[model samples]
Target: MLKGKLKLPDRLGNLVVDFEDRDDKIGGSSSVLASSEELEIILPNGLGFSRHKDDGDGLCCTEEKKTNEAAIFRASARPYKDRAGSVSAMAFIAADEKRSDFEYQSELKKNTEEELSSSKQNVDGDSDGLLRRHEISSEDHPLSLGKASVWNQYFQHMDIIEQIDRDLKRTHPEMEFFSGDTSFSRKNREAMKNILLLFAKLNPAIRYVQGMHEVLAPIYYVFCTDIDEKNVANAEADSFSCFVKLLSDSVDHFCQQLDNSSGGILSTLSRMSELLKANDEELWRHLELTSRVKAQYYAFRWITLFLTQEFNLQSVLRIWDSLLSNPFGIQEMLLRVCCAMLLCMRSKLLSGDFAANLKLLQNYPDVNIEQLLHVANDLSPDVSSYCPPL
Candidate 1:
């Protein structure tokens, strides 16, 4: 396993690897390490991996030649002096601290009534995160989900998006871009209404949810290539129908959340809660004991709307640029944001515990978004003695 990992690059993410090893000097003498290599990743079924050559374009300049489902990575075995363990270790430590900070912020929610009352406005503001003020409606921001004409218009946007997606993959091998056929161009409000009806027919479990439109906002931006692009002529009918099918499939993540045990919006927020508890037992206990568990409700909308409903639309766009471009890191980024928000209300949160803590947390959003961003970006590791293997 060491030899195999040594053959790859010094950084990896979202991949799993298997290896058989018995090394007393390393983690243990276990015959098999389910995950032993820190910098190695196993490719998922659809991913295509390639190596960079000194004279080559590094897989970004051209489309992948091999479409195979499985492959191993290798590179020149350079001297150990070239290792970037410090930098990689920093990322791992940052991730761990992020987990701890999330717990700390949650615990801080417990405080006295006086502090909670004064901090109430902040909590409401933070509950929404930074929301975009721009509103999309049938008249101005019309999206025709299922109509033939709307589908055609939507295709024009998809073409632009698909081209960009392919280009990005070639240019940035580390990033992933998703594009599926979905239409947004509607000829009329009636067509748009029919599209929604169709969406319901396809998935009866998901009646329309308010924030879903915002969830699909990226597709609109990507498809149209610009927010300024107005409605265009609808395309061929056959192409439009195919595109609608894809659109339905593409938006499933948001849709799935709608049907989640908790409302769809809350489910993603809960995903963070579940992950934190599974990964950090001590911090979880601290939060429960402190009576700060209600922070989850305050943090819910930030995840559901992708922070679209909380701040200026322009700033929200920048946040989305980070969130969509790096889905893997966004969850951690969110936890950091939660911590930063709590820090802004530290006076209130620190005043007391238990019932007081819940009251304090109720008024969370009073902190400034800019301050939250700074804390999130500069967050340090939580310094726990029981640091687990990454």
Candidate 2:
């Protein structure tokens, strides 16, 4: 017989108890544990119980069995301390007549609690006393609780959350809204974090990435810096909606699964290369042959991050205006813009070798925005031309 005082911890409100029998050896003789005997527990009135089957390994309590032969009974208890610092016991007991195991186990838990209470009372009657009984239903249990805040659903993605926080802190360090320890900066960082979190939560596949904070910074900043002071306070909410809208069109590029589809990043790169070949065949061939610079090598970051990584804050914002305004969609216009960026540097790229050209494309030089957009608008893909692989 195992006998010892078991004090339940405060945090064990969702505790699950498992009962199993093992062979016992007395005086070098083995004896099998009998299933005929029933264990009894005397618990307080408020406690509740339910019968469930052991799913596997007899360790975890699974869903309640339908046949009513209770293979296992589990009791959940919530312990609370009163004003006088006296701890009260509340437990749940599972009862079913169809199964001897369930009936015996239910009785066992009830009797055990009652015996423990009696023993405690004998030791110190007035010191620690049981409080008024409040019934514990299945619905009241924490495990059976309803859905919490929508944000709570993403608790498993805490790593994503940490990454977002780190990225938010590092993004646009020069800007006061995202940089320092001021309340405004903290608010902006939080706004950015919330938007990214919601985006990941909604789209489980593409979820959050490192560079996304950069993409969202401008949107949130613009909303916060609105002319109307009232709009400033609601910047985060407005930014979230706008960011979702913006991401809807461009999210495909970020999805790795879609990278090789007809409309994936490869397709976009092909389109850009085709546009380049049509507009400036000499420049395209020179980069592809002599310079050995492929579109994916340089254009992957440019296209996926919405060119946010290639340019300064002011220039990116200007480019985004055109991107967001284009009814034909940003993908086509982005290809044109990328081509224009290359063409704008045609003079330098023509003279440079593979290394120099690759560096130039990776770290793009400044150009006249008005002229670049004009050149981009003028250029269009020759659909008839076969776009050979780079």
lDDT of residue 92 for candidate 2: 23
The alpha-carbon deviation from the true structure for residue 137 of candidate 1, after best TM-score superposition, in angstroms, is 39
Question: What is the C-alpha local distance difference test score of each model?
Answer: 0.45, 0.71
Query: How many residue pairs in model 1 have overlapping backbones?
Result: 25
- Model 1 lDDT tens row, 270-300: 5555444554555545555565565455566
Superposing every Cα of model 2 onto the true structure, what RMSD results?
28.4
Q: Candidate 2 on 1-390: residue-level lDDT in tens?
A: 211112224323213121112222133223322454222332344433443336664422333332221222223234433223423233222223346687788999999999998977865666456554678665555455344433334454688899999888888777776888999789778878888988898887888977988888888888888999989888888999988887776688888899898767888788788889888999999988877889899999888888887887888899988876765466777777889999899999999998898898898888889899888878865566434222
| Structural similarity to truth (TM-score) of each candidate | 0.34, 0.59
lDDT of 1 at 349: 52
Q: Local error of candidate 2 at 57, Å?
A: 94
